[model samples]
Target: MNSKSHVPFIRTVKISERSGKDTIKIRIAAFVLALTAGGLFILFLGYNPLELYGTIISGAFRSKMAFQATIRFMIPLLMSSLGVALAFKMRFWNIGAEGQIIVGAVCASYFALFHDNWPHFLLLIVMFAAGAIGGGLWGLIPAYFKSKYDTNETLFTLMLNYIALHIITYLRDGPWKDPGSSGFPKIARFTSNAQLDKVLGVHFGWIIALILLVLVFIYLKYTKHGYEISVVGESKSTAKYAGMNVKKIILRTMVISGGICGITGMIQAAGSDMTLASSVAGGVGFTAIIVSWLAYLNPFGILLVSFLFSVLEKGSSVMQSTYGLSTYFASVLQGIILFFILGCEFFIRYKFVLTKKGGK
Candidate 1:
């Protein structure tokens, strides 16, 4: 007599032909599931999930002031995401937006502190240009190393962030320290000429951010340089075979990327902070990475995601004030929501199949 055995086997399969409708449906499902999970967490904390959700919505849009605040929060995040999207489109993994932003702020502040006698518009322009140059140079360092030595850009860029941060510390405690402050280490505030004027109720950074959105969209979708970046991102060998100068492309793209992020730093210092500080970046550089990925590296998508994230952040603050919840709790809620939405991408691209096997 022969013995037979049966077993179940599982295999992962890629879904290469998903439609737009299917993708939307999966995302919707993931969002609903995330809400459910977050609701349960709220329940466990002895809170009404529905009420909390409503609070979040109203808090972000309840008044003109609230709306303005949300826009303010969105400005740097939107700008930084746009910068990161450009580099990511080229598959460069430029994680040094934080460093780039810091250096830009430092450069902008130099003009703000010393060149206050210039006309207001001229001063602002000079600061902007200085910031762009500063950030571009800072970003170019990693790109040069990567092109020459094939170094790991991710780590290089990340390490640069710490160095840039320490630069601010050195300035505040050393050369740039305010002599007027009594025993406190801080930089001097910018003069009126260096400050950004308001358009509605908020600073004009929002207007700049919108302009950048259109520019980046057109740049990525229509221009030759954008096309070259896409080719390089797909395959360097193919790019080289197509007669494209891959090294030049890498260097130029990073300059643009870092320049945009530098503008973010300039805006933060001049438009909001009115002074450069270590907190000027405020993790906006890191948060922009999440926004860039969530938006699929599309400039328009980045705008939408950045707005949504701004709302989440502003609303979370309100939730904390209203419910007396700890900041960590709000962060956990945000993390839970993000995890579900991000995890859904895996399902959109792949699926599992089970098969039965028999042996004798």
Candidate 2:
């Protein structure tokens, strides 16, 4: 009936069968805990924690490249998180987003590579469509298993991730292997027109990401399908009793989720990398799951939180350069934040009472 995270800060929130009452103070306390943990880590390294924090903020916004990097990172994160959020609205855990992303990249890349000279605009359209279809199909696969045989969707989706990885590996060393290239282990270089163009020095992927965010917001807030998803997520029995096709919504939402994830793959492929391989997903799909969870599946909140992660990643590069810190240090920082946020979610749902002085 309820889920819990094995985080230490368990008293931060109290969640229930539905929405639970909450106060802002709990959030502030959790932040304080996160900041304390992060600050202590810096102090343990014998570095000025204040300088580290300051450097991060400065790097994120003080330079053009830094700003662009933040935007670049934010776009995929926003797109993936929104997709995750949409499915989450239906309580459908489609964890194969990473696979869907890879499938999309592979589809678009293969199409662009083999297809004869078509219009530049047409090529772009094909790539986008291919990416969406690949991801959608990957997503639908799990839905099929779940609806047709009552398979555990979480496990079904999770397993698909490895399938994507295996396919990427096979291609990197086999069919898609470029004869001219050597041990770097990647795909062949794509054509110039295969890449997405920049608008005002920022990749146009950001524009698409923003447009999708708004579209998702509108769909979830105003549409009947969205209403169905919410109902089905809350209860299959209730949804069925209400004459809503619960299984259909689950399958439909997942397809949409996967399609968006595929678009994200396209951004990394054509918009940024201009090629595809195992690195196509860039772990954004996994991270976006948390972003969606933390944002409570609100598209607008995902925008803000995704921006936060983007800044952290951008500033992390500065941390590496200015303080001679490892880029892994940023991962440490993010891990800490995620720990706290996830802990808070659990606490929002459950509680522990210390009845004895012994603190059982």
Candidate 3:
């Protein structure tokens, strides 16, 4: 449908460390540029940009519930984004994480559906294993094809998204439909013991997510495999030439990426939603791409940017009704923001000058 939310096909570029300053400047410039674009759009639509933004600010920050909602939204997005960031760092495109999350959630749901009476400890094990295995399998499909037949992973993974959506829809409507409900769409409520704990009105998934950030950070920084990932991502041919097992690393890193995404799905099922539905994943796989990009492939940066996205998303509803701003306005804002960020990269990498090198 090419909605305004559609992410453009941005070729991955591994920026050097030297560009860190440029990255900061880009963030500043992108904010300014996005604001300008948003203002112009609001004027064209016969609305005040100031009013729209002010409403969003109050809506997003005025209440504790809004803050909790923001954390809830950020946690899964951060999880999925971390997965994507790892894959992107390795030069592997995991566009099917959306599908992988569904695979994980669907599998976790089944575990609880049947093992509802198992002890909490054993049930947790069963759920996590199912979720990890499910997402890993989903990831393997694309990796297998890419590794064996040199297939285009981008297309392969994109198609998997729809396949997964249909699978969840079928399960909820047919086999797993709650017996007492007439037309509602959802599975039986999941077992309570299988879910993550709520911390101060929020899920412990956020806490786990933060711990993962540190672990993944250390994993990539100090481990030999992380070194190989960077090397292979830099050049597969070069990696192979240097005695690194290119194929093994590809499969293994992807498994890691997929496994984490599966955990994200499990959290959504166990901690947040407590059941399987067509909307279980909430398009998180796609949004994670934005998070990864904004984080500049830095896990710590992903953590902060994720929370920022949460605010905008949760605030959109307020903007919609409080100021009569359409939902489309949110999409416009994201687009403009992304545009400026992408454009800023150009300024960082190259400088414009006249052919004479002096005259304008």
**Which number leads on lDDT?**
1
Encode model 3's per-residue lDDT on 1-360: one tens digit a residue.
Answer: 655554434334444454567668767978787888888888888888787777777778889998888788888899889888888888888888899899998888887888878988688778878888888889888888887787888889889989999999898888888897777766888767766778889978888799889978887779998889899889999999999988888888888888888888888888888878788787789888877887887899898878778777778877877766666666567767877888877767655542332221
lDDT per residue as tens, model 1, 1-360: 435443337766797968999998988898789889989988998999999888877989999999999999899999999999999999999999999999999999999999899999999999999999999988999999988898999999999999999999999999999999887699999988899999999999999999999999999999999999999999999999999999999999999999999999999999999999899997889889888987889999899989988887888888889998765554566567678879998889999877645411
User: What order do candidates take by lDDT, descending?
Assistant: 1, 2, 3
The parts of candidate 2 lying over 4 Å away from their true place are 1-22, 345-360
Question: Candidate 3: lDDT of 314?
Answer: 75
| Candidate 2 residue-wise lDDT, 135-252, digit = tens | 8999999998887898998988888988987888898788888888877767887787787889978879999999999999999999999889899889999999999877788889
In terms of lDDT, the poorest run of 10 residues in model 1 is: 1-10
Best by TM-score: 1
Question: By summed lDDT, which 10 consecutive residues of candidate 3 come out lowest?
Answer: 351-360
Which residue pairs come into collision in candidate 3?
Answer: none
- What are the TM-scores, per candidate, against the unseen true structure? 0.94, 0.89, 0.90
Per-candidate RMSD, Å: 2.7, 5.3, 7.0
Clashing pairs in 1: none
Q: Check candidate 2 and list the clashing pairs.
A: 13-347, 13-348, 14-348, 14-349, 15-348, 15-349
Model 3, runs deviating above 4 Å: 1-23, 356-360
Candidate achieving higher lDDT, 1 or 2: 1
